[model samples]
Target: MLEKVRYEGAYPTREKADEAVRLVLSGLGRQLTGDERVDLAARLPWEAARGLTAQIPDTRQLTGWAFVKDLAARTNASLATTRWDTGSVFAAVAAHAGPDLLTRILHQLPTGYALLFGRAELTQAA
Candidate 1:
């Protein structure tokens, strides 16, 4: 059952960002180890998530902007401008079955999980 969660524009609270990240991490199978997950999960600025997301592999394959553009068209939210960041992508699906569908995403997202997790950009925290 997919409950309707609102995409509240930009997250004004860390809780919101955290929830979104949790959802995405869960969705991505948390492919990262506990330490890696901890590092990514730690409190940081939105811009930092962008940089980190860009570093993650298979992320390049993620058509975040396009997905949001499509989602906006389907929903009342007119999110015309595609924000090319992980949080934005997470927010895109937060309203649907994201957090709940972690298992499925885990199997689907990782083309080569090592490629992403091993990257210095993703592992090197600020």
Candidate 2:
């Protein structure tokens, strides 16, 4: 998983990739709840799962944009950098999640998460 993140993110070292992974997953652990959270945690490898499950769930859900912004503030990184980091981590996560679980995850999350996971989010016309 770290190898995937390191290569995908083009990070200087495994340590850097590990840091990015932890930060983003910890933020997500705080945000996600219920079945989505538990399911995703079970799907991820142990370390990633721990990073994702360690946080006490946030009672209020944030929009995808708000999630990115909140993560940036928590990490003291610029929004652009934080967004990049989030995508890097989530892209790897999406790969582990597979299509079925990924679809379910996107359904639970607010808009913009699909793109973060490196998937296009298409909506049905009413």
Candidate 3:
């Protein structure tokens, strides 16, 4: 999942990024159901996102402008400059599968550093 999800912006340190992950995990744990828990657990090692550093390529060496540009292209979303202090990236995976499909995919996403916003069809990945 981490490999498929493109990351954007300057996370000063891994700890900063991990802080976001921690917040997301706490929120998501409260949103789970019995079936969802079972399905997630069966997927493999439970804390997949925690292993993100190992699985995903590093972007730290890239220039800030280059990093954001690459991520924006990969995710098919523009990086917002006005709201730069907030969430730097604004991404949306369109409905090749429609709203229901996206909802399921999103429900599986870790919530801490990542935020879900906007309408069903045009969901924003911040």
* Top candidate when judged by TM-score against the true structure: 2
What residue runs in model 1 are displaced by over 4 Å at the alpha carbon?
Answer: 1-10, 30-126
Report model 2's TM-score to 2 decimal places: 0.93
- Per-residue error for 118 in candidate 1, Å, reads 17
Model 2: number of backbone collisions: 0
Candidate 3 lDDT by residue in tens digits, 1-126: 222122443556655444434333333333433454344334423453232212333323333344344444544545563123123222212212245543554564433222432333334679
TM-score for all predictions?
0.24, 0.93, 0.36
Instruction: State the lDDT of candidate 2 residue by residue for 1-126, as single tens digits.
Output: 889988989999999999999999998898888888898899899999999999998888787788899999987899998888889999899888889988988888888888888888778899
Q: Assess candidate 1 and give its lDDT.
A: 0.37
RMSD for all candidates, in order, please.
13.0, 1.2, 13.3
Q: Candidates' lDDT values, in order?
A: 0.37, 0.89, 0.36
Which of the two, 2 or 3, has more lDDT? 2
Ranking the candidates on TM-score from highest down gives 2, 3, 1
Name the top lDDT candidate: 2
For TM-score, candidate 1 versus 3, the one ahead is 3
lDDT (tens digit, per residue) of candidate 1 on 22-49: 4444434323333433344343345434
Candidate 3 residues lying further than 4 Å off, grouped into runs, are 1-6, 48-102, 105-126
